[model samples]
Target chain A: MIDTAVLKQKLGDLDEDGVQALLDEFAAGTPSAEETQQVVEACQQGMEIVGENFEAGTYFVGDLMYAAQILTAALEQLKPLMSAGGGQAAKGTVVLGTVAGDIHDIGKNIFKALLEAAGFSVIDIGIDQAPSAFVETAKTNGAEIVALSGVLTLSIASMKETIEALAAAGLRDKVKVMIGGNAVSAETCEFIGADYWSKNAAAAVKQGLTYVS
Target chain B: MSEEKLKIREDLLAGRVPKRVFMQLRFTLEAACGLAGVDLVKAHFDPKTKLQAYRKVCETFYSDSFPIENVRWPEVYAPLGAKNWVMSSTGAMQHPEIESMLIEDYDEYIEDAFGTIMKKILPRIYPKLDPALPGAPLSFAKAYQRQQATGGEEVGAQIALSEEFDYAPGFFVGLFCEAPFDFLSDQLRGFRNITLDVRRIPEKVEAAVNASLPLMQRQAIPRNPIPGFTVFIPLHLAPYLRPADFERFYRPTFDKLIREINKAGMAAFLFAEEDWTRYADALAALPENQVIQFENGDVQKIKEVVGGKQIIGGFFDPLITLTRSKEACIDEVKRLLDIGMPGGKFFFAFNRHVLDIASIDVSKLVAVLDYVHEHAVY
Candidate 1:
């Protein structure tokens, strides 16, 4: 049996091969749904170390990036096992997109990876989406949380428009809204009617984890 | 008076203490148009309207000089049918994360940078540049000539108008260049692909960046340097890398560009566009006097590390000007100046470019600029 603790450390250290080797070994042995879930939890906790180190200035975007990719691959190796065993149901669905008028997505993509690792089905609508598109996507996906990301100033206006669109659709009351990007802040979050905001990716995933927990 | 306004910060660039903190500012084309109440699409296409709008915005915004926001050359991008750089509905030109080069082609690219870009990348983004289509080259050549000529005429007219308004572009680099790693991610390998490549094919990424540096520097740095200007390099990659990765992949090339430009007696104005608190020591290690305009970081830490070694500018957040009340806006300006002004080489500028008038309070912006112009003295 692979020690999830050692796997966590290896992932945190950004040992891509080591992390994969451990995950592959666990998968090669017909792992149980609970075991798969436990390993997934370990990866999530490992990403926490990555995020903490990023905040502490020891790691950076590149490290977080590599860790995200590695964690994603690790999760993929375990997904089949989890499925055969009817793994834990996803926590909830989160609809994510870069808000209209802004196309910057580095932060958005990173958050998506971590969110998926943390076990949420995220439907990422691509960039330059209109409020109508966001409204339609959120409604069709039956999203529990809508995450809007934009780095430009005009995106704030677009964010407000999108929230108003959701409100107009009568879906605003049901789904919590989160805005992430440099353009979002406490003041703008309030102005835009979002439930939470994050400027950086690591903190964003942390916020997402808190939302469901 | 206009000439002095244009060269307001030339003294600081020349290694002398100035009477006041020189405020460095740039309003992206759409932002300037928004401030002037001009339609973006119209101004984007019409050179005459854009020049007028830029002048009006600069005057009203109380900038000491005309901003090098951008040069609108429709003839260049329109005919090329550039997929990455396109006009957005929100009144700005946004570059999509598109890569023309495939990851497997790194060896071929490293072998011949220019040939690969010209032969492989340009044609893919701009199908009009495909050699297989006969006369495509001729068609593009004609467009290039017309674009250059029109660009020169428009810029001349804009400068003349700014001078008439009594504030002209102080020092502006007409050419745009990129740091090596930035070029790799932005131009060839898309961000997602490059992020994976950095870890997967680490050696190949290093080799490609190293191979491309000389070509980029030679093309960017001038033989006869402009006294007050340099090739503008908007840094996009270094801030994302950790210090070790940055030093390994990005720093050498970044240092070379700065060193080559400075050796020719001109300073390279680098728009460092993210938190660079990690790379302070690395920047400090480089030859000093490069214009490093930061976007966000601890101002006091930046002042401590790269203070007088380089001409430090930017720390004030433009978001504050957009979101805060007038009193709060001025207070933030005061805070930035209190930390940045004591150092002889420091100048004031917002960390991010002024993107548009939609989010920003025009009154607060004016008040903030007026306060900086008056109170941020050495």
Candidate 2:
């Protein structure tokens, strides 16, 4: 007999400790459908706190990384009990990676986390990924969206080549290709033939979901 | 005149020699001399020994010829070692053994070493250097201070140049403040936080901007001989930011910096390091004649916003250019030039530094440069 109102109140405050205690109470017994929704909502609240801290400069890469881990842990616990189809419906799948010759993954990882939280299935291909590898992964996973990540100025061309290869393979139209990284631009996106250009993780997730939907 | 010297001189005047070639030649020569067990100090005194070492390096690494032509070379620019030394010393000051040896205490020592090294090296390598060449003037502020300390008259700081050098000058400026937004999240926060902050904590953000403006304004001061442009690289506004955030957090700061830069009699080079497509209206509000070197923005949209007002540079992906074949390289360069190089004041290079790529194809890159020189119009 968990009080859903109290759980939602704790979640809204983004009290991680309070949310964790509420989660523990739910884990001890079967929580109703509304109670499970409260857990999901609590996770969202935690995300908001992380976002707030990040925006205010009190949080950093380490904090964002830890928040992602926290969300993942709580999500894993709630995944089984989540209404079989009641959880937000995923828009589509996106296969993302940092292009070859670039080993930066912080941006890509954050994008993946944001996407997952937004209820999109993400297959992160990691860094230093070849153009062919992106095409192969997209084809294998039936991913509707292919996202390329790059941080170095040098890797923009590689990202373009990947997009060109995707087009050459005649798979371009089937999948919406998005490019994000420090070095990419919309003109470069159009020049490279990518479908979308996003500056960071949150926008990438938003645009990715929109494209799939 | 020596054939090699004549060739290099011609290339420099034509701006055909890529900067990387000098770096590669220096690196290869150093390595070969080391491998041959040549004593650097001994060789410095003996012309014969130095020439012999050079010949060996040329023969083994740079082909068996006396001079290499149109070959791509590595660019090995020297960093501000004194700054690095200071930073490292400051980092180490936290330790028990060296806590007392603060960076300020080591300033004189660092200055002396830096000045001595510059004085010893500059005249030897760049005797006939021009101070007015773009990117030719190096910042040796520490070295100059050391010269002053060592009873050397103010002869002015020496400018190092070589016939084989190509210089592209750029800089990074902080876009926002450190008080309201932490530096780490400021670097990586997405647009969501950007938007929410404006709606929720506008006053705090404004205070941070106000506090940060003076520091950013100071960086706009141009101190070097060859007037290099100052480019402010902003990382705060990105995916998590929206048009409203830009208006609130970014616009006023930029307006202040632009005004300061203009007042200082310097050009403002704005390097937007994020996708600013959604906030084009805010970007367009920036002052005119300032160059906008976009890192990861929507190019067409950027062009629409600032194309007429500012000199736009970048958007080429350096990675593909490094790895692709010469044909592909030529095509990409030509295309970018057609779009980005149309208006005068438009300079081109890899959208960013080519940190990771196969070595730059010097010939291919040179070909693009030739095309741009021939075709670029205002």
Q: Write one digit per residue (lDDT tens) for candidate 1, span A1-213.
A: 689999999988998999988987998887888888899889988988898898887887778778888988887788788786776678888999988888778778888998887778899998878898888988998888899988787798889999999999999998889898876779888777888888767877767767777
Q: Mind giving the per-residue lDDT tens digits that candidate 2 earns over A1-213?
A: 466566555543444467678778887898665667666765665565566566564554434555565566678888777765367656688898988756666678777776786677888988778888999989998889998887655457678778888888878989998888766666567667788886645446657767766
What local lDDT score does residue B215 receive in model 2, on the 0 to 100 scale? 49
List ranges where model 1 is wrong by over 4 Å. A30-38, B1-3, B72-75
Name the lDDT value of residue B167 in candidate 2: 18
Worst lDDT run of 10 residues, candidate 1 chain B, spans B167-176
Residue B72, model 1: lDDT of 50
RMSD of 1: 2.4
Categorize the docking of model 2. incorrect
How much is the lDDT of residue B252 in candidate 1? 84
Reference contacts preserved by each model: 0.63, 0.12
Candidate 2 has a TM-score of 0.48
Each candidate's DockQ: 0.59, 0.09
Angstrom error of the Cα, residue B64, model 2: value is 29
